[model samples]
Target: MSFKITDNTKVYIAGCGGMLGESVYQTFTDTKCTVKATDINLTAPWLSYADVSDYSEISKDIKSFAPDLIINLAALTDLEYCEKNQEQTWLYNALGPENIGLIANELDVPVVYISTAGIVDGKQDVYNDFDEVNPLSIYAKAKYHGEVFTQNHVRKFFVFRAGWMMGGGPGKDKKFVNKIYKQLKSGQKELFVVDDKLGTPTYTKSFAKGILEVVQSGLYGVYNQVCNGDCSRFDVAKEFVRLLGLEKDVKVTKVDSDYFKAEYFAPRPFSEKLVNLKLNARGLNVMPDWQEALEDYSKVFIEDLA
Candidate 1:
């Protein structure tokens, strides 16, 4: 049965303070659902403390809420950090979902787990929803474990694997777009971006909306919920600069991954590009094209510059 997200519906969201969390929070809140959003950071007034790694802490909080739905958005996304802190990464990215899966089983409610495109090694040009994942890094391995855990333990679960995420604007965007904008803001005339990397740009707002739609449909399973198309990192940066009307002011230089091997020491796939095969087959893909999403998202950064 499809669980409707009405005003009275109660949702317990863990790790609701990141770039993606901001959009998820707003999207659900706008629907007037009763939400208990939590994060250790407490970046927003709507967010409270919840360490997802500690099952005891999060289980207590979630059980108290007695939510009809559980969305585990918590993840340690930094590749380098995850590589260095293997144990912590496992706790957050792997065991965290295990905790949520346990609680969801207890409550018998649906759960939403966000996975990543980074899980696949770049041997394939593009990945579908059912591709065999060869996780290359500690972060990817941990996230893949979480995905598998959710599938195995939870009866009704939506594991949405996102691509290169782009949302939350300047204040919250911690991914590629924000990184490029920060360099531009810092008065860098030329931006060196790696063209070797390839992936879909998943807009947070669109992804959040897709989650709501899919969950409401009650078609519960793993889905590749990324934007309609894909591109390389250099393609994204060049388009982003053009969107900001800074094509003349700033120059985007294309380079390979080796250019910043020391800084980005963590193992990354040559291509993280994902195709929304399942979502499209189901007729639930609501994500805009990469360029369209980028243009709309750039307005926030442009305003910040003013």
Candidate 2:
């Protein structure tokens, strides 16, 4: 599978406001691929505002841009929010990708869809590309729909399933790691984390680079794109405190999911680690370990706090 994308090749990125979308946009730009970024809320010079649910809106943009590859990175990823607002979640997560797939199919162009490892039943120790999906929440179910729709609708598509994304974006991060950092930086001396819930944390920039490698290779299918190691919320919080040189004595306590029953009522998978077998088999490198990725990511904010 040999593919070549030059500076003249146009690549359009949908959902350019989120962390993953921002990283994808930057990666393509760095690679010298002619890029056009689009999102519903166009805040940056590179972004064009368009709602993906409106077929006319997305189709018009696709037709006008005439890109060789379209990367659909827009998704409604708030698990609890999805549980509360099922209709909006499905519309944004499932229907949005369906519309993108339809447009890409009509134009006979490939689409790179960013999916999530959350689709797998977290009961399993780890999941691979071929693992059965047992989504525990509306958010995961919606993302799974996007994955299925993409595969069925488009002849050439790459579904990259990423886990607990970190890094990139401007104040858009709400993952566990970022939350821990915020709490600690706010001068909280104690933190309570669930020791049972487990998954790999992915750095957006590294994940974006892996996706580009797959695109350049022209090997299209579902692939797990995540850091090399897995950890629980407790593990991540501990690492966050350690890296910041915060007091090791800053009392970190372990609790069960039941502790936050009111705040997090949505059913969550206990573990959602995804193995990057496909990338490895193809001789393509996956992202670095979550610990290493976090260390690099902390550099951006560590100085600001100090």
Candidate 3:
């Protein structure tokens, strides 16, 4: 790494409660850095209430801290919620970064914005850092706008696009893996998982550590920051059942997108397979293979199955 992230460094984490934020908070705090954590809902004593959608309030709060670096992980992540609330969605996903970018530009603070692999068209078999973005959903477009605003305003910016994140255990996990785990844990004999959609399942801790390295290495650019390999939702479900020794009881039946059409109406990219090409090229990639990471994650976060 060209630069060192020492304890003396002051970092302002805009969001810090969910699986990803919790993991990022722990990883950075392990470095003994002065991390000021904030969130829309103050989940912990260290986490102050800071609404990302409100530019004035959030900017003023961040300025009081006078951080050397700013990492904005705040966003309206619910795809359907974003689709229904377009204005609020834009405000949180795009305008929030624009606001933070403005603050960073003023204070000369470098900023890191967490984006998603969902911003692609899913037409390709796999997406790399260099692939052209074709955002298919409101959430994707808004996040892409965040990336653009950050690039336009911040002198040093790092946008890391993550894939199907699998961390936050129990109450914090709001994604696919945890959802299936919950269903099976409730004595559901059959679990219908999407087989057509393919993507990497990113472990939050791995992503946090990997992205931290890139940040410390002083590499400032857009990068695909998912786990090393790809799998379908059906594959992930099978792995979950296998890990919990419920394979015998739980039947993971493969289903297509149409199965979820009645409830999950938000338009999703057909596929979200992302490769860490840029990180690999720079020799700074530390993301583990998806299967290895999954095993590690299941040890701590069995989705309330225990």
What is the descending lDDT order? 1, 3, 2
Candidate 1, residues 182-230: lDDT per residue as tens digits? 9999999999999998899999999999999999999999999888878
Q: Summarize candidate 2's per-residue lDDT along 1-306 as a digit string, tens digits.
A: 656789888998989887777778888999797998999876577787988888898899888999999999887767888999999988989999999999998989899998998888877799988888898789999999999999887889999999989976226676776777778778899999999889889999899889888888998899998999899988888887887788465878999999988998888889999889888898886599999998888886688686
Per-residue error for 200 in candidate 1, Å, reads: 0.5
1 versus 2: better lDDT goes to:
1
- Candidate 3 has an lDDT of 0.87
Which pairs of residues collide in model 2?
Answer: none
TM-score of each: 0.99, 0.96, 0.97
Best by TM-score: 1
Candidate 1's TM-score: 0.99
* Among all candidates shown, the one with the greatest lDDT: 1
Q: Least accurate stretch of 10 residues (summed lDDT) in model 3?
A: 297-306
Point out where model 1 deviates above 4 Å: none
